[model samples]
Each structure stands twice: as structure tokens, then as C-alpha cells.
Target: MNALQFIETSIEDGIGYIFLNRPKQLNALNRKMVREIVTSMEAFDLDPQVKVILLTGNGKAFSAGADIDEMANDNPINLELTNQFADWDRISLVKKPVIGAVKSFVFGGGFELALSCDFLIAASDTQFSFPEVTLGVMPGAGGTQRLTKLVGKMKALEWILSAERINAKTALQYGFINKIVAPELLMEESVDFARKIAKQPPLAVRLIKESVNKAVDLSLYEGMQFERKNFYILFASEDQKEGMKAFIEKRKPKFTGG
Candidate 1:
């Protein structure tokens, strides 16, 4: 794995952190940056040592959106050849739990990125929007599909069409962001939360995330069947046996991602 220029990555105590590093650009998603992000996610997801993946930015804004400067070219041939949006889609396929630690601005593509995560902990001052309508295009990523599934049709339509910004409070009220913390506590709280999740039985955690995500696209009956199958399969894992034994023994279970 080569060092990434557009993103900073580190793993500590079972948690992997991927920070958007282009502070000068408000951590905007460009081709290079998005590719680096997808690469980092793939690496972390495959690493048995990493139990959870935490994503955030190093600047005032999580990201202002896609690199509008590059979007201005409007070359369809170039866009297809680059396969830009496909790389962004790869983030969703990562099987590990992903948590978003957001602050300031999370707009357009940035908003979609956050939605891709299993959950998000955001700063109270965070501002989210999908301003692609104003750009004469729509969110080319999964924003339209994910946002509608998340916040309902009316709210999704209002935000996407109007391109208005919603503060963290509103976003939480609308059931998107999981929690809001003071800006100073953002990183600490997010990491602490990730660490707590990292302490869980790894196989159970991954299956839980996978099952819930599948529920989004599946009918209630189908989803329940899938959930039941996953639940049954976990009983066959060593971690599950240890977890149950620990409960009976009144001790913390040491899970080795088995």
C-alpha cells in the first residue's frame, strides 16, 4: 500500500481512521481523492486487525462537494472513461462498519458519502446540502436513492430540488445524522464510539451491519428471513461461543475476529 496524498490513514486499537486531507480545498471529492478513499476503504475492510472504519476531514468542512472546478468541463466522454462515480459506489460495498465524523459543510457528493456510512456523528455547526440542482445537474452518486430511503420522499425532494442547506440539528431531527456534538468533542466522541463498537464480537457486528443494509432493499418477509439466517450462522463462529461463555463467566470476551 503506497502512501496516499489526498487522504491520511491510520489504524489504532482496532479502529481505522481515514481523514480527507485536502484542507485547502475544503476536502472536496475529486477523482484522485475519491479513488484514494475507495482504496483505503478496501484495504481496511480486508484487514482483520481493523474492526471499524472511521471517516472524517482535516479542515473546516467535511467537504463542500465534488470538485466543481473539474465538473465545469462537462465532457461526457471523459466522464465515462474516468468512471468517477463507480469509485464512490465502492464505499458502500465495504463489509466493515463505517462511521462518519462530520463537521462544517457536507454538501452534494459529501452528503452522499456520509449517507454511505452505517452511521454519522456530526458537529452541531455542520451544514448539509445537495446543491447539484443549482449546478444544472443532479447528484450523480447514490444521494437521490439513499436520501429518499433515509428521510422520506417529501423531505428528500425539498432538499434536492431547492438545494438548501440544513444545519446539524435539522439533519438529526430528520433522522439522518445519528448524533450531534460540540465541535471540540467531535473527533473524541466519534473515536470513542467507534472503539466501543470495535469491542463487540466482530462476526456479529459485520453480520448485523450487512443484514440491516440488506433490509433497505428487501421486503419485510425477505429481510426477516435473511436476518434469521445470519443469526443462525453466527452460532457457528468461535466468537459467538466465547461471547456467550463470557456472559456466563462474568468476564469480558476477547474476540480475535473469529
Candidate 2:
């Protein structure tokens, strides 16, 4: 594949990495950058070697937000013609987990992009906000929905309406960010987390991810049924047999994603 202009892609230890590469522009989510992100993620989804995907910024800020200069003059018709949001939707369709390791100024679309991940690990200095309201707009991405689902309407509205910068600790308190580490240790900790999950049985990992994401939208009964079905389905997998047999033999299980 040709070298990407807006992002960098790499694979290591069963983890696929997407680094938002526009550092000087604060890694803003522009059309080209978003396309690269979607394309890389789709590629990783198809690659058997990639068990997990990690998304983070390449520089000082994860992202300042989307490219305002590119969108400032847009109207409904132009937006409709582009169908710009379809690219964002592609992130959710990915079968493998995508972890967001973010820091610094994660605002507006950056905050929304982070939410698109399966989970997040942030640096202690990270600050998140949905400042689209300040521009007489609102979060066109998942911010309003995911954030509200995360911390409830009260906190979501408070932050969105005020455009308040919610610090890392507060975000942790709200239960959006999975963990926060020292700025210098951010990448190390996040990669370690990804590697840990990558070591799990790949079939189980994929099913578990599918079950959990379904929990967000499905009713409790439907979600439980979905989970139960998956639980039963795993018994038919070779990894499940290996896992139990290894436990009985007091030996480590080796899973081949079968």
C-alpha cells in the first residue's frame, strides 16, 4: 500500500496501530485523515495477524478537534452530498476492538472520536470537551449519545452546553476513560494493555467484544439472550476446548483462534 498522508499505520505483536499524524495541526479530524483511519481500521479488521487495534495521536495533542476551516462554510446540502458521516460509521463496523490512547486537548470531534473506540486509556493531563455548542452547533458524532450513555444526561449536557474542559480525573470519575497514566508513560501503558488483550483467545475476544457492544443498544433481556447464545457458541470453538482441558491438566492454554 502507498504511504498514508494523514496517518501512520503499523503492526506489532498482534496489535494494529493508527497514529493521527498531523501533529502541527493538532491531529485534527479532517476528511482525508478520517478516510485514512477508516481504511486502515478496515484493513486491520481483515488481517488475521491483527487481534487488536490501538488509536492514538502522534504529537502533543490527540486532536484539537475536526478541521474547522474545511467545514466552516458548509450547509445541509453540501453535507448531504458528501455524506461525510458515513466514514465515521465505519469505525463501529470493525470487528476487532479499537482502543483509544489519548492525551492533551481532546476536544469536539476528538472527544467524539475517542468515544468511538471500544474503550480509552488517557494520559493524566488529558482534557476533553464538546465545544461544538460554542459554534452554534452540537456534536454531530457520538458525543451526545455515547457521553450521555456514559455519564448520563446531566453531566453530558453540563459539559456540552458549557463547553467545559473535563480533565482526565473527571473523565475517569465519569467512567469513560478506562485508565489514566503519567504523560510520559501513556504509550507504554496503553500498548501494554493492548498486548494483554491481544494474548487472549482470538475467537473469544471477538465474541466478547461483539457481546459487550451489543449491550449498549440491546435491552437487558435481549442482551442476556445474545450473551447466552454467544456463551454457548464458544463451546463449539477449539479454543474453548483447549482452555478447559488445560485448566484440568493444570497447564497454560494455547489458543489458535480456532
Candidate of highest lDDT: 2
Tens digits of per-residue lDDT for model 1, 136-202: 9999889999999999999999999999999999999999999999999999999999999999888
Cα lDDT tens digits for candidate 2, 131-224:
8988999999788999998899999989999999999999999899999999999999999999999999988998899999999899999999
| TM-score versus the correct structure, for each prediction | 0.97, 0.98
Where is model 1 poorest over a 10-residue stretch in terms of lDDT?
A: 249-258
Error of 1 at 110 (Å): 1.0
**Model 2 regions lying over 4 Å from their true place:** none
> Model-by-model lDDT, in order?
0.93, 0.94
